[model samples]
Target: MYTIKYRVPESARSGQSARSEEKWYHVSILTQYTCTSTGASNKKRLHRKQYCIATTKSSQLENLRSEFGLPVVMDPIGNGNCQFAAVSYHLRQYGIHRSEETLRQEVVTFLRQTPVLGNRICGANWWTSILKQPRNNLSRMSTEYEYGDQITLQAMSQLNNMQILIVSTRNSATTLISPDGSSCLSSRYPLIILGHYPEGAGEHYVALGYKRHALERIVDKSAQVTWETDPPTSDDDLNVGGDDLSAGGDNLSAGGDDLNAGGDNLSAGGDDLSAGDDDLSAGGDDLNAGGDDLSAGGDDLNAGGDDLSAGGDDLNAGGDYLSAGGDDLSAGGDDLNAGGDDLSAGGDELSAGGDDLNAGGDDLSAGGDDLNAGGDDLSAGGDDLSAGGDDLNAGNYDLSAGGDDLNADGDDLNACDLGSPNTSDITRLREMVQFKRNRKHVHQNRHVILPREIWCIIVDIVLKLSPLSRYSLQRVNRMFRDLVGKTPPPRLYLCPSRFGDVTVSPISVRKIIALSGSGSGLVQAIRQLIRHSSWVNAWLFLRLATLCGWYTVEGIWYRRKRRN
Candidate 1:
């Protein structure tokens, strides 16, 4: 039904950015066809030309280089652990070198601890299924490993406080996961760029390294743009527009000379000249002419005083003549003068002039008279208003205005003028209003009314869910800092040894317990233990515990108790 053709780059140089070349493709489709019963068909083909870079590994790699300034892509072994390996490689740059397995364990632990996020990522039964196996065994099972998706990457981002950039080679699309799972594009967190390539089996991930300064500049610019063009909220629509207009007006006012030049041309031809004639007619002609002359003369006396004065007098006289002519035309004064005796004898023309003056005054005051009439109606409707209020207070009663029964067939007119309420009803209404005010005050200050014990319990639950969140709690307030300090640390456990594994000995356990009383002593003990033991055993027991999870004094105590 369709055929597609792609044009390769003109100069296909290895390691060169494909973005520099113009790329396009042609797609031909059979849009229409006519078929005959005689086994023959006539078809019409539609050809479409599209300008776009081909979605291939080479092109994507080139795009990454061009956009991110030649990031170094470190290919990890594609043995189903590529995602974790890539993450581990990137972490090494930040002085947080971790083995792939350790990283995987950490990811699994974090996902397990956060049930809401875990259930969303996998399924509600994900943890239940994994529970059948030992935690350590589950981490070691290669078949259990899942291909890193956006949700998993987001989990890792939140856990490590690191931002991840996933650039897909199969398509010209990139996904950036921020530390807080928000749309915020800027963060001080270390950025880890992971290149994703589609394989026959599945997708593979590789770490990408770039100049930190360039990345920082790009992030800062993006943040600046985001802040400058923030999405408008409800109030922002009116407030922001008003603020922007005020700012623009201020800027225009700052260049007052230039604005004044433009204003001078506009006022001289438009407002000043045209408005003078209109004002002269609207006002009594004499006063308007004198005002206009004085205003004009004050501004331009030195330039042309005599001409302005002469022009003012001539205009004033002409304005008075025009005013007299307008009155005569409106009232037929000339006709009345010519037929004076006849008009007086009839009395009709004199009455007609009076009627015309009355009509003009009525037309001018029509709107004001209507508004005053509406006010009078409103004042008369107040008794009906009290009847409606009484109905509302009666709970289930139907409205009956003016104490007339609404249910009565011929009582409609009587119901519209309910006079007033009694003293008891007024007192009850006041009490109801006061009760609502008291309830509102209670609800408004509910947080402040919470007991200290309740707050402590809430803090304990939070710390239990996330031990590292203690640092965040410390920054909340002095009271919270003290509470978090008083709370004991979460219990930790060493990884359960597999069957036939002989890694950790009792003597080594005692040495760790005795030395791990302080932070410095704990580091010294780990260093000495690693130095003496085989790399494999040391990695499994000490390094993995330190990297993937905490090794607690309780764990050491448990080991000692079990041996005894």
Candidate 2:
């Protein structure tokens, strides 16, 4: 129902003729009311074209060509002949015998005779205008499709019982859609459409670069192909695809994929086999494999939980109190036992021995603390090995690898000398006194260091630095934010003078502490420094003191008044 027109500027039309811009006038859509066989209730959308008086130049349609990425040709079939030309172009490609002029005349005939077109039917001139046409030419012209519209195309399609896909182009922003409905129509099956121009000016249409049917994919439905996932699941027969073996019941066999629920004692020899909690046996290379007396062997084997005993090359006895035997093994749950060359028992009260063995939990006793009695690399993380609450004692050359209290009593074979000097019977008593005197210094400073030694050291260094230096260090990271926060400000002098006598004032200490950001403790240190000290120049201190905010005008006034 909406009408869109495009007209170019007069500047671009300087040397252009009427048909010059026709290359840009692509497709115009018009609607006509029609009735169906069941009744007038059924309505259908139709495509139509009108003889647009204005023309559009090719330069104005460059955007359309760039977007669609195809060559464009203006309509050469004159006014009112677009539908016939468009339909004839498609029919000839499909080897249909049809002329463009003949189709145009037929489209005109279909529109004039259509009952729904009513009094304003297309190609039917007024009674007064019809008198000017010659007698024979009047009949052909009335049905000659002076201008083709949507209803004209519909009637032709209904008569031939063929459906056609048409594309209408309006502007540069518009995207060309494919016959399949979502994509651009293949260039092989080219269609005509309107191009870019100013509104209500000139209308233009262009032919696309290719044909539509030539780009369609031809599919053959008669060929037969086999799929691997559809393998048969006969009893004891392996499934080809290895997925969803058998849903009927248990004891159903499948190869390649994992197994779901099945019968008791069902044996699965697949690559990655799995079974329900109920009793089941798997002899697969990997994955879970178990039975009542399950024997599993592979790189990684997991005998599912329960009172099931597993004996294989590699067995992981994950069940409670379950016994497992393999070269490399791991066992979980309480009271679970395992016997292997290299064993790891996780439960409490586990007794295991091997070259590399680990026994966790309380009361885990081994013959010599480690599997290899005198071998290196022995680690026991559990508490209370051997005698309950005693240090876990390993034999000579073997260490209690876990916590220091490997044995509950904190006693171990690796005893450290607690600075107790061992003196021979022949040694003199005087020499021992000398050694004790030297060791006294160590005990005296033992309480000097805080528990957090590293943090205290970094804080002391940061606090001793100058104010500017401390400021730079404080911004290094968030961790040191408070380290330099209480640091004292820089002082005018670094060392005291030796020639002149130095004196300390309570008021100066208070003033310096307030300005230096140092606490009252700094005053005590300053007092101790200047108590017996001497400065090289006494006047230097007085002059620097005033500049350093040590002396104020009020203090000077009070001193002069006291002197007066």
Candidate 3:
């Protein structure tokens, strides 16, 4: 048997004083025992104790109000269709009044049409089960009673092209599902806010409404919260204390020292004992040992030990060794040793038992021979040798002794080397330079080029001539070819050759010219050609024209005869 304890606040309990302290309650749970083959019993028990706080529905509603700024919650019918009912009621506020049954049917239809999206939003098994059916009226009617969840809300958001904010009363937090999977809510689309409240028997959803500017403030807060916090986990245990901690302050530390360390550590000394100031001795002198030890002294004795001896000196044993003493032994101010037999004396003196050693104030000598120590000659066994000076010589031979000698020798060598220039090369170079200078000016200037409009007019006149002439004109130039190609061919009127033999005719040349000028020449020509093209029509036309002409002539001749 195991026992668990809970402390319920007096304000949270019914019919209790609001200012009263909390009271503890105990509950017991029995463990199951299984018998093994050896006749021994093993007891199965829970490893860790889990505590939960249950709030009243009114308190939960108040939390939803404070967090989401939704003071009004319209409860829907809890007939397993509360999700759709809540969504329908929310849409009704925006003048899109849809019934719960209509929204359910729309969701089903959307899922059926887009199976891929349905499978992604809802699980594959759920989608496959929805697809499989005697999908008749009976299956659909059965689905109408099925409860909806976040999957249904996602489908509704995508189907209606809107955003859904699920203000959960359990956690006092808002969950925003956008069509584009972003943290922001698109202002162009309507926002549907739904409240999820826990009921005694089951969970129910209600439509929530906000005040005038409360919606914008809540949305901005939600976006800020979404970015500032880690994504909530799926486990109920992990999400349990999130609301409690977030409601406290901006960070975990703001929950006070109790929740900061006691909640997770559960020790008496808290985090102070584990890794605080006391554990590492960071607040005291334990690590440093003492003040005067290990680099604590004023003169940095470990690095630069100033006074290792009695007289505030350095590395000295006898008479002020390695100090600023005059005429001291090893390293002193004036002399290296007494008796003037110093190994390295400061002033001018003999050294290494010679007149001068390595380098004297005035001269330097090795083996009683003066080296190049001053402004004088250096000799090795009687010969004056100079390595570098105004004059330099080696073994009585001058080698680049003077700067003027080098310059004069170079000038004489140049005078003996070269002769003259080539005249033909000079002439060719001058010609090349002149050709490059005149290249930009080499272009022909034409003074007589006709304008494009004049050329177009001339081409138009030529096109009105015979077909053979138009064809010959097209072969003139590229411009003429293009212009003739662009211009439409002149209308041709063909009539019977016999029609031309008739001297007088119904249609005269002046009539044809008048029709062409009126832009109906094509129609009139076609009509006349059709009238006189066949043999019968041509013969009839000819007979008519000749009879008319002959009658007129006879009338004139008869009048003349009568007068005579």
Clashes of each: 3, 40, 0
Off by over 4 Å in 3: 1-68, 118-142, 171-173, 198-202, 212-564
RMSD of 1: 28.2
Candidate 1 per-residue lDDT over residues 311-371, each given as its tens digit: 2332222222211212221222212221111111121122221221111111111111111
Which of the two candidates, 1 or 2, achieves a greater TM-score against the reference? 1
Tens-digit lDDT string for candidate 2 (107-156): 45554544332223333432333344433343555553355444444455
Each model's lDDT: 0.41, 0.35, 0.42
For each candidate, what TM-score against the reference? Answer: 0.25, 0.19, 0.26
Q: Write the per-residue lDDT of candidate 3 for residues 353-383, one digit (tens) a residue.
A: 1213222232211222211212211112111
Give the lDDT ranking, best first.
Answer: 3, 1, 2
